[model samples]
Target: MNAIIENIDVLLSGFLTTLGLSALAGFTSFFGGLILAGFAISNNPTLRKISMLYVALMQNIPAAAHLFFMIFILPVLGLKAPFFVLAIIGVTIYFSAYYCQAVRSGVNAIGRGQLEASRALGLKNMQTMRLVVLPQGLRNSVPPLINTTIALIKVTAIAGVFGVTELFGTMLQLINVNDSAVIALMLVTGIGYSLITIPAALAAAAVERKVAFNS
Candidate 1:
């Protein structure tokens, strides 16, 4: 407690950075996933294949590998970005694949009957998908999407490896500065993370219940 009080500023700074990175990555991945999901379900075989390949590639590789590739390998190829930008890009790409799968499952859950009915109403494929399918599929996907976002938030800790200065990075610094206070500082870090994740989990549960009731 005393240690935490003394280092409150450092903790808060890192917490806010982590929060911002998670939020940015989450939003980018959500939209990017939606785009990929569309392609995955499209009538065009080529687009579907491309989307599937992307998802498979991302899922097979670990996030740390992706970060290392972006931060270390990309520079060799003459592409460079700040660690902050690279972290967001890396996290977004890594998580977007999971999001794509979650959204694809939701889309697949919509029955062929719904598609047939939409076509029977003289709706084109794009129109039907935009107006009818996406609305319903996205609702079904809310819970899993929320879970994915939560997982991504936790994964931002990995960004510390590239010196992104997020929550885990700050904790490591604190540990180095005051080794004896490790346990106390770690407990406080856990509390800080809980403050974000607990609320997100509760909200996800509420959303799931509401979605289930509506269905």
Candidate 2:
């Protein structure tokens, strides 16, 4: 109790850092996924291939490897960034593949009839995708993407291992010196994470229900 009371400010700071990472990564990954989804469905064969290559590479790679490459390897190549920025970059890239798939799943749910109709109406491929496919695809994608975003928030805990001192990292730091309060520290960390995740999970469930109802 004393340890927690004494470290309230530190815990709050780390919580804020976690929030920042989650929010920034979520925002960037959303756009990244959208663009990749677009390319995957494009008329240009090269673009579709590029999209496939990118998604395969990102999806297959371990999340830690992505962060490790950014934080340690990139510096050797003369690319430098703050640890936080690197964390964001790594997380955003890894999750973009997931978002891409979500959006792609949405695109697949779209009827072939509408696609053929678009061409019958003289719309070019891009025009059809932009005007007809993506809007509906994106709408359908919301629930899964929300679920993915929840996962995204949880995965940011890995950032702590890479020296970002986020929520989990803060708990680790506190536990080292306050060894007797280890269980308390763990509970605090779990509660902190649950505060964000529980709500997102509930919201994801709600969105999922709404989407299913509408569909």
Candidate 3:
């Protein structure tokens, strides 16, 4: 308790860093996923293949490995950036795959009738996807994407291992020096994570209900 009380500023700073990382990664991943979903549904064979390959590679790789490659491997290739920037890139890429799936699944869930209707109106494949599929699919995807976001936020803890001083990193640093407050430090850190995840989770449910009600 004394340790936490004294190090309140440090804990807050770590929590804020985690928030910043999550926000940047989340927004970019959402955009990337949307674009990839478009690619997946495109008429062009090359675009479809590119989408498939990207999602496959990202999905198969472990998130930590993605970050590790950027943090360690990329520097060797002279593609160096700040460790924090590398972490954002790694997280965005890794989670965008999952977001892509969430979107693709939503698009798939659309009734065949919708596609037929678009075609009957002389809408091209790209136009149908842009004006119809994406709008509907994105709405259906909201809840799942938010759930994915919860998972993403939790996984940001891994970034600490690669040099980001997020909440978990703060806990580690404090525990090493304040062995007696280890349990308290851990509890507080867990609470910090819950503060973000719990509200997002609750909001997911509300959004799900709203979407369902509207549909």
Tell me the whole-model lDDT of each prediction, alpha carbons only. Answer: 0.88, 0.90, 0.90
Q: Candidate 2, residue 59: CA error in Å?
A: 1.0
Across 16-132, the per-residue lDDT of candidate 2 in tens digits comes to 999999999999998899899888988789999999999999989988999999999999999999999999999989999999999899889888888899999999988997898
Quality of model 2 by C-alpha lDDT: 0.90
Model 3: per-residue Cα lDDT over 38-134, one tens digit each: 8898888999999999999998999989989989999999997988899999998999899998888877777788889999999998899889888
- Report the poorest 10 consecutive residues by lDDT, candidate 1: 206-215
Q: Please list the Cα RMSD from the true structure of every candidate, rounded to 1 decimal place.
A: 1.7, 1.9, 1.8
In the range 5-54, model 1's lDDT, one tens digit per residue, is: 89899999999999999999999998889889888988999999999999
Show where candidate 3 strays beyond 4 Å: 121-127, 213-215
What ranges in model 2 sit over 4 Å off? Answer: 117-127, 213-215
The reply for model 1, stretches above 4 Å from the true place, is 213-215
Instruction: TM-score each candidate.
Output: 0.92, 0.91, 0.93
